[model samples]
Target: MTNTPTHNRERSCIACGAKASKADLLRIVRTAEGISFDASGKLAGRGAYVCSPECFDKARTGRLSHALKTKVSNEEAQVVAQALQAHIQRA
Candidate 1:
């Protein structure tokens, strides 16, 4: 038998509050430049996760800004939304 890790890092969706594995969710990172989607999940900054586009929409209203502890303007939110949409399409 081969040894393997059983526990996976779990994260909660900022908008829906649903718990899911890190790999199953999309990560959004907040950096000095601005907040954006982290496709690689390795960005060096504060991160938030969302499980679906619906959750993302909810987050766009307010949860995301609160979770990131930063003010996300309309333009920034739009850009993030588009990026996430594209990422989802690719997947």
Candidate 2:
């Protein structure tokens, strides 16, 4: 078999507009159910990336909902942020 170089997919943070490898950013998915933190980054829905909690805070205001093309309430955003924080702490 021919050897091939692995390619890292790059994505932009919705909050800061910073570019980075997909794995380096936290992913949030929006589906019919609602928006939620996507730790596995494999959820089937519209996804948005944020580089950090500070970025997430910025995004949660409006950027994230705009990126996802849905209305994300402040309460929903807070819940997702909490989940993301818990995940980060565990990691």
Highest lDDT against the true fold, candidate: 2
* Candidate closest to the true structure, highest TM-score: 1
- Deviation (Å) of 64 in candidate 2: 0.8
lDDT of 2 at 73: 95
Candidate 2 local lDDT, 1-91, one digit each (tens):
9454467688999888899888999999998899999999999999999998789998898888899999999889999999989988998
Model 2 worst lDDT run, 10 consecutive residues: 2-11
Give the runs in model 1 whose Cα sits over 4 Å from its true position.
Answer: 1-7
Candidate 1 is scored at a TM of: 0.89
Colliding residue pairs in candidate 1: none
**Tens digits of lDDT, candidate 1, 17-62:** 8988899999999999998999999999989999987789888868
Task: Report RMSD (Å) for each prediction in the order shown.
Answer: 3.2, 3.8
